[model samples]
Target chain A: MPVYNARIIVTLRSSILDPEGTAIEHALHELTYTSCTNVRVGKYITMNVEAESEENAREILDQACRKLLANQVMEDYSYTLEETEREPA
Target chain B: MPVYNARIIVTLRSSILDPEGTAIEHALHELTYTSCTNVRVGKYITMNVEAESEENAREILDQACRKLLANQVMEDYSYTLEETEREPA
Candidate 1:
Protein backbone atom coordinates (compact mmCIF):
# COMPACT_ATOMS: atom_id res chain seq x y z
CA MET A 1 0.00 0.00 0.00
CA PRO A 2 1.15 3.52 -0.80
CA VAL A 3 1.66 5.96 2.06
CA TYR A 4 0.42 9.51 2.05
CA ASN A 5 1.48 12.43 4.23
CA ALA A 6 -1.18 14.95 5.03
CA ARG A 7 -0.79 18.31 6.75
CA ILE A 8 -3.97 19.79 8.13
CA ILE A 9 -4.35 23.38 9.29
CA VAL A 10 -7.36 24.25 11.40
CA THR A 11 -8.06 27.89 12.11
CA LEU A 12 -10.67 29.70 14.17
CA ARG A 13 -13.48 31.39 12.27
CA SER A 14 -13.05 35.15 12.10
CA SER A 15 -16.18 35.79 14.12
CA ILE A 16 -14.95 33.61 16.97
CA LEU A 17 -13.00 35.24 19.78
CA ASP A 18 -9.50 33.78 20.16
CA PRO A 19 -8.34 34.45 23.70
CA GLU A 20 -5.14 32.51 23.15
CA GLY A 21 -4.30 34.68 20.19
CA THR A 22 -5.07 37.81 22.12
CA ALA A 23 -2.81 36.83 25.00
CA ILE A 24 0.01 35.99 22.63
CA GLU A 25 -0.41 39.32 20.88
CA HIS A 26 -0.24 41.09 24.21
CA ALA A 27 2.90 39.17 25.11
CA LEU A 28 4.42 40.15 21.80
CA HIS A 29 3.83 43.79 22.59
CA GLU A 30 5.36 43.35 26.02
CA LEU A 31 8.40 41.87 24.32
CA THR A 32 8.49 44.96 22.08
CA TYR A 33 7.26 43.10 18.97
CA THR A 34 4.73 45.87 18.71
CA SER A 35 4.10 45.46 15.00
CA CYS A 36 2.31 42.15 15.43
CA THR A 37 -1.45 42.40 15.03
CA ASN A 38 -4.53 40.32 14.37
CA VAL A 39 -2.95 37.17 15.67
CA ARG A 40 -5.04 34.02 15.38
CA VAL A 41 -4.06 30.67 16.83
CA GLY A 42 -5.23 27.26 15.61
CA LYS A 43 -4.09 23.68 15.11
CA TYR A 44 -1.59 21.94 12.86
CA ILE A 45 -1.96 18.22 12.32
CA THR A 46 0.27 15.86 10.38
CA MET A 47 -0.76 12.31 9.62
CA ASN A 48 0.61 9.41 7.64
CA VAL A 49 -1.95 7.19 6.00
CA GLU A 50 -1.90 4.02 3.92
CA ALA A 51 -4.21 4.03 0.92
CA GLU A 52 -4.64 2.60 -2.54
CA SER A 53 -4.30 5.90 -4.41
CA GLU A 54 -3.85 9.63 -3.97
CA GLU A 55 -7.56 10.20 -4.29
CA ASN A 56 -8.26 7.58 -1.65
CA ALA A 57 -5.71 9.19 0.65
CA ARG A 58 -7.29 12.60 0.19
CA GLU A 59 -10.74 11.26 0.91
CA ILE A 60 -9.52 9.57 4.08
CA LEU A 61 -7.70 12.65 5.27
CA ASP A 62 -10.67 14.85 4.53
CA GLN A 63 -12.89 12.62 6.57
CA ALA A 64 -10.39 12.55 9.41
CA CYS A 65 -10.22 16.32 9.50
CA ARG A 66 -13.96 16.73 9.30
CA LYS A 67 -14.78 14.14 11.92
CA LEU A 68 -12.13 14.30 14.65
CA LEU A 69 -9.32 16.69 13.84
CA ALA A 70 -11.36 19.87 13.69
CA ASN A 71 -14.55 21.29 15.13
CA GLN A 72 -16.44 22.44 12.04
CA VAL A 73 -18.63 24.89 13.91
CA MET A 74 -15.89 27.12 15.32
CA GLU A 75 -12.97 26.28 13.08
CA ASP A 76 -12.25 25.80 9.38
CA TYR A 77 -9.74 23.20 8.23
CA SER A 78 -7.62 22.80 5.11
CA TYR A 79 -5.09 20.16 4.14
CA THR A 80 -2.35 19.19 1.71
CA LEU A 81 -1.67 15.57 0.82
CA GLU A 82 1.34 14.02 -0.86
CA GLU A 83 2.26 10.43 -1.65
CA THR A 84 5.44 8.92 -0.26
CA GLU A 85 7.19 5.57 -0.63
CA ARG A 86 6.95 3.10 2.20
CA GLU A 87 10.04 2.82 4.31
CA PRO A 88 12.07 -0.40 4.08
CA ALA A 89 11.55 -2.62 7.08
CA MET B 1 3.90 51.23 5.76
CA PRO B 2 3.61 47.74 4.28
CA VAL B 3 1.75 44.94 6.00
CA TYR B 4 3.18 41.45 6.15
CA ASN B 5 1.38 38.20 6.76
CA ALA B 6 3.22 35.49 8.62
CA ARG B 7 2.20 31.91 9.25
CA ILE B 8 3.87 30.06 12.09
CA ILE B 9 3.71 26.32 12.61
CA VAL B 10 4.85 24.91 15.93
CA THR B 11 5.14 21.19 16.55
CA LEU B 12 6.38 18.93 19.27
CA ARG B 13 9.81 17.37 19.00
CA SER B 14 9.58 13.73 17.96
CA SER B 15 11.16 12.67 21.26
CA ILE B 16 8.31 14.30 23.13
CA LEU B 17 5.11 12.32 23.65
CA ASP B 18 2.08 14.12 22.30
CA PRO B 19 -0.94 13.14 24.38
CA GLU B 20 -3.24 15.22 22.24
CA GLY B 21 -2.01 13.45 19.15
CA THR B 22 -2.50 10.10 20.77
CA ALA B 23 -6.03 11.00 21.77
CA ILE B 24 -6.87 12.13 18.26
CA GLU B 25 -5.36 8.96 16.77
CA HIS B 26 -7.45 6.82 19.07
CA ALA B 27 -10.52 8.77 18.09
CA LEU B 28 -9.70 8.20 14.42
CA HIS B 29 -9.34 4.45 14.96
CA GLU B 30 -12.63 4.39 16.82
CA LEU B 31 -14.22 6.21 13.92
CA THR B 32 -12.80 3.46 11.64
CA TYR B 33 -10.26 5.61 9.87
CA THR B 34 -7.82 2.77 10.34
CA SER B 35 -5.31 3.80 7.72
CA CYS B 36 -4.32 6.96 9.60
CA THR B 37 -1.22 6.73 11.73
CA ASN B 38 1.54 8.84 13.23
CA VAL B 39 -0.75 11.74 13.89
CA ARG B 40 0.98 14.77 15.42
CA VAL B 41 -0.79 17.89 16.60
CA GLY B 42 0.69 21.33 16.92
CA LYS B 43 -0.16 25.01 16.76
CA TYR B 44 -0.88 27.16 13.73
CA ILE B 45 -0.60 30.90 14.14
CA THR B 46 -1.33 33.63 11.65
CA MET B 47 -0.29 37.22 12.31
CA ASN B 48 -0.42 40.49 10.48
CA VAL B 49 2.52 42.77 11.02
CA GLU B 50 3.47 46.26 10.05
CA ALA B 51 7.03 46.61 8.82
CA GLU B 52 9.02 48.81 6.55
CA SER B 53 10.41 45.84 4.62
CA GLU B 54 10.06 42.09 4.31
CA GLU B 55 13.35 41.50 6.08
CA ASN B 56 12.17 43.52 9.05
CA ALA B 57 8.92 41.57 9.09
CA ARG B 58 10.75 38.26 9.04
CA GLU B 59 12.98 39.36 11.90
CA ILE B 60 10.01 40.43 13.98
CA LEU B 61 8.12 37.21 13.31
CA ASP B 62 11.13 35.07 14.17
CA GLN B 63 11.51 36.88 17.46
CA ALA B 64 7.81 36.46 18.23
CA CYS B 65 7.97 32.72 17.59
CA ARG B 66 11.11 32.14 19.57
CA LYS B 67 10.21 34.27 22.54
CA LEU B 68 6.48 34.07 22.97
CA LEU B 69 4.66 31.86 20.44
CA ALA B 70 6.55 28.62 21.10
CA ASN B 71 8.20 26.98 24.03
CA GLN B 72 11.65 26.11 22.71
CA VAL B 73 12.40 23.25 25.12
CA MET B 74 9.90 20.74 23.76
CA GLU B 75 8.57 22.29 20.57
CA ASP B 76 10.01 23.33 17.21
CA TYR B 77 8.68 26.19 15.13
CA SER B 78 8.83 27.37 11.51
CA TYR B 79 7.25 30.26 9.67
CA THR B 80 6.53 31.82 6.29
CA LEU B 81 6.35 35.54 5.61
CA GLU B 82 4.81 37.46 2.74
CA GLU B 83 4.42 41.18 2.18
CA THR B 84 0.95 42.50 1.60
CA GLU B 85 -0.38 45.93 0.79
CA ARG B 86 -2.00 47.80 3.63
CA GLU B 87 -5.77 47.59 3.82
CA PRO B 88 -7.67 50.79 3.12
CA ALA B 89 -9.49 52.45 6.00
Candidate 2:
Protein backbone atom coordinates (compact mmCIF):
# COMPACT_ATOMS: atom_id res chain seq x y z
CA MET A 1 0.00 0.00 0.00
CA PRO A 2 1.19 3.50 -0.78
CA VAL A 3 0.98 6.09 1.96
CA TYR A 4 -0.07 9.63 1.14
CA ASN A 5 0.43 12.69 3.31
CA ALA A 6 -2.58 14.95 3.37
CA ARG A 7 -2.53 18.54 4.48
CA ILE A 8 -5.95 20.00 5.13
CA ILE A 9 -7.06 23.53 5.88
CA VAL A 10 -10.52 24.39 7.21
CA THR A 11 -11.34 28.06 6.93
CA LEU A 12 -14.33 30.04 8.06
CA ARG A 13 -16.52 31.70 5.46
CA SER A 14 -15.35 35.17 4.49
CA SER A 15 -18.47 36.75 5.91
CA ILE A 16 -17.80 35.23 9.32
CA LEU A 17 -16.34 37.32 12.09
CA ASP A 18 -13.17 35.67 13.43
CA PRO A 19 -12.40 37.06 16.82
CA GLU A 20 -9.13 35.12 17.02
CA GLY A 21 -7.93 36.63 13.78
CA THR A 22 -9.18 40.08 14.66
CA ALA A 23 -7.28 39.98 17.93
CA ILE A 24 -4.12 38.95 16.14
CA GLU A 25 -4.56 41.70 13.60
CA HIS A 26 -4.87 44.23 16.39
CA ALA A 27 -1.75 42.82 18.01
CA LEU A 28 0.14 43.13 14.74
CA HIS A 29 -0.91 46.74 14.40
CA GLU A 30 0.35 47.39 17.89
CA LEU A 31 3.61 45.75 16.90
CA THR A 32 3.95 48.34 14.10
CA TYR A 33 2.62 46.18 11.21
CA THR A 34 -0.07 48.70 10.41
CA SER A 35 -0.23 47.76 6.75
CA CYS A 36 -1.48 44.26 7.45
CA THR A 37 -5.26 43.87 7.32
CA ASN A 38 -8.20 41.53 6.98
CA VAL A 39 -6.70 38.78 9.08
CA ARG A 40 -8.55 35.46 9.34
CA VAL A 41 -7.61 32.25 11.08
CA GLY A 42 -8.41 28.63 10.38
CA LYS A 43 -7.24 25.07 11.13
CA TYR A 44 -4.39 23.18 9.53
CA ILE A 45 -4.54 19.42 9.81
CA THR A 46 -2.11 16.78 8.54
CA MET A 47 -2.23 13.02 8.55
CA ASN A 48 -1.14 9.97 6.62
CA VAL A 49 -3.60 7.95 4.59
CA GLU A 50 -2.63 4.48 3.53
CA ALA A 51 -4.49 3.37 0.46
CA GLU A 52 -4.10 1.45 -2.76
CA SER A 53 -3.73 4.59 -4.92
CA GLU A 54 -3.75 8.35 -4.93
CA GLU A 55 -7.42 8.60 -5.81
CA ASN A 56 -8.37 6.35 -2.92
CA ALA A 57 -6.30 8.46 -0.59
CA ARG A 58 -8.00 11.63 -1.71
CA GLU A 59 -11.43 10.09 -1.36
CA ILE A 60 -10.72 9.04 2.17
CA LEU A 61 -9.37 12.45 3.14
CA ASP A 62 -12.19 14.32 1.48
CA GLN A 63 -14.63 12.23 3.46
CA ALA A 64 -12.70 12.98 6.62
CA CYS A 65 -12.89 16.71 5.92
CA ARG A 66 -16.54 16.80 4.98
CA LYS A 67 -17.74 14.46 7.68
CA LEU A 68 -15.57 15.56 10.56
CA LEU A 69 -13.05 18.31 9.95
CA ALA A 70 -15.24 21.14 8.72
CA ASN A 71 -18.67 22.55 9.38
CA GLN A 72 -20.62 23.00 6.15
CA VAL A 73 -22.77 25.88 7.31
CA MET A 74 -19.92 28.15 8.27
CA GLU A 75 -16.60 26.67 7.15
CA ASP A 76 -14.87 25.52 3.96
CA TYR A 77 -12.10 22.99 3.58
CA SER A 78 -9.28 22.28 1.13
CA TYR A 79 -6.54 19.69 1.07
CA THR A 80 -3.25 18.94 -0.63
CA LEU A 81 -2.10 15.36 -1.04
CA GLU A 82 1.38 14.04 -1.71
CA GLU A 83 2.48 10.42 -1.95
CA THR A 84 5.23 9.18 0.30
CA GLU A 85 7.12 5.92 0.48
CA ARG A 86 5.49 3.40 2.74
CA GLU A 87 7.29 3.01 6.00
CA PRO A 88 9.09 -0.22 6.67
CA ALA A 89 7.20 -2.61 8.91
CA MET B 1 2.42 49.65 -3.40
CA PRO B 2 1.72 45.96 -3.97
CA VAL B 3 -0.66 43.86 -1.91
CA TYR B 4 0.19 40.31 -1.02
CA ASN B 5 -1.96 37.52 0.31
CA ALA B 6 -0.12 35.61 2.96
CA ARG B 7 -1.11 32.13 4.09
CA ILE B 8 0.71 30.99 7.18
CA ILE B 9 0.62 27.60 8.89
CA VAL B 10 1.91 27.12 12.39
CA THR B 11 2.46 23.53 13.49
CA LEU B 12 3.64 21.99 16.69
CA ARG B 13 7.12 20.55 16.74
CA SER B 14 7.07 16.80 16.18
CA SER B 15 8.15 15.95 19.71
CA ILE B 16 5.33 17.98 21.24
CA LEU B 17 2.08 16.36 22.31
CA ASP B 18 -1.02 17.25 20.29
CA PRO B 19 -4.11 16.25 22.22
CA GLU B 20 -6.52 17.84 19.77
CA GLY B 21 -5.06 15.81 16.96
CA THR B 22 -5.11 12.62 18.98
CA ALA B 23 -8.77 13.04 19.84
CA ILE B 24 -9.61 13.60 16.19
CA GLU B 25 -7.63 10.56 15.15
CA HIS B 26 -9.56 8.40 17.57
CA ALA B 27 -12.80 9.79 16.24
CA LEU B 28 -11.71 8.95 12.71
CA HIS B 29 -11.10 5.39 13.76
CA GLU B 30 -14.59 5.24 15.22
CA LEU B 31 -15.86 6.62 11.93
CA THR B 32 -14.06 3.73 10.17
CA TYR B 33 -11.22 5.80 8.80
CA THR B 34 -8.70 3.44 10.33
CA SER B 35 -6.08 4.05 7.67
CA CYS B 36 -5.61 7.62 8.78
CA THR B 37 -2.71 7.94 11.19
CA ASN B 38 -0.50 10.44 12.95
CA VAL B 39 -3.02 13.23 12.82
CA ARG B 40 -1.73 16.65 13.85
CA VAL B 41 -3.48 19.97 13.89
CA GLY B 42 -2.23 23.53 13.62
CA LYS B 43 -3.32 27.03 12.77
CA TYR B 44 -3.90 28.49 9.33
CA ILE B 45 -3.77 32.24 9.04
CA THR B 46 -4.52 34.47 6.09
CA MET B 47 -4.02 38.21 5.82
CA ASN B 48 -3.41 40.99 3.37
CA VAL B 49 0.03 42.49 3.61
CA GLU B 50 0.54 45.72 1.74
CA ALA B 51 4.20 46.17 1.03
CA GLU B 52 6.52 47.56 -1.62
CA SER B 53 7.49 44.19 -3.10
CA GLU B 54 7.34 40.47 -2.63
CA GLU B 55 10.50 40.54 -0.61
CA ASN B 56 9.09 43.14 1.72
CA ALA B 57 5.90 41.20 2.09
CA ARG B 58 7.76 38.04 3.00
CA GLU B 59 9.85 39.91 5.50
CA ILE B 60 6.83 41.44 7.16
CA LEU B 61 4.97 38.14 7.39
CA ASP B 62 8.02 36.36 8.70
CA GLN B 63 8.33 38.92 11.41
CA ALA B 64 4.69 38.53 12.30
CA CYS B 65 5.02 34.77 12.55
CA ARG B 66 8.07 35.01 14.74
CA LYS B 67 6.73 37.73 16.99
CA LEU B 68 3.23 36.44 17.65
CA LEU B 69 1.89 33.71 15.34
CA ALA B 70 4.07 30.89 16.62
CA ASN B 71 5.60 29.94 19.91
CA GLN B 72 9.28 29.33 19.16
CA VAL B 73 9.77 26.74 21.87
CA MET B 74 7.01 24.37 20.77
CA GLU B 75 5.82 25.42 17.32
CA ASP B 76 7.18 25.77 13.81
CA TYR B 77 5.76 28.07 11.15
CA SER B 78 5.85 28.41 7.37
CA TYR B 79 4.05 30.68 4.92
CA THR B 80 3.21 31.06 1.24
CA LEU B 81 3.10 34.52 -0.29
CA GLU B 82 1.21 35.60 -3.40
CA GLU B 83 0.92 39.09 -4.81
CA THR B 84 -2.55 40.41 -5.55
CA GLU B 85 -3.69 43.51 -7.38
CA ARG B 86 -4.28 46.44 -5.11
CA GLU B 87 -7.95 46.98 -4.38
CA PRO B 88 -9.34 50.17 -5.88
CA ALA B 89 -9.80 52.83 -3.25
In order, what are the TM-scores of chain A for the candidates?
0.95, 0.95
- How much TM-score does chain B earn in each model? 0.95, 0.96
Q: Against the correct fold, how does model 1 do in TM-score?
A: 0.96
| TM-score for each model | 0.96, 0.97
Number of backbone collisions per candidate, in order? 0, 0
Show where candidate 1 strays beyond 4 Å: none
CA deviation > 4 Å runs, candidate 2: none
lDDT of 2 by residue, A1-89 (tens): 99999999999999888999999999999999998999999999999999999999988988999899999799999999999988999
Question: How would you encode candidate 2's per-residue C-alpha lDDT over B1-35 as one tens digit per residue?
Answer: 99999999999999999999999999999999999
| DockQ, all candidates in order | 0.93, 0.93
Candidate 1 interface RMSD (Å): 0.6
DockQ-based CAPRI category assigned to the predicted complex of candidate 1 = high
The ten-residue window of minimal lDDT in model 1 chain A covers: A61-70
Cα lDDT tens digits, model 1, A1-89, are 98999999999999999999999899899998889999999999998999999999988888888888778999899999888889886
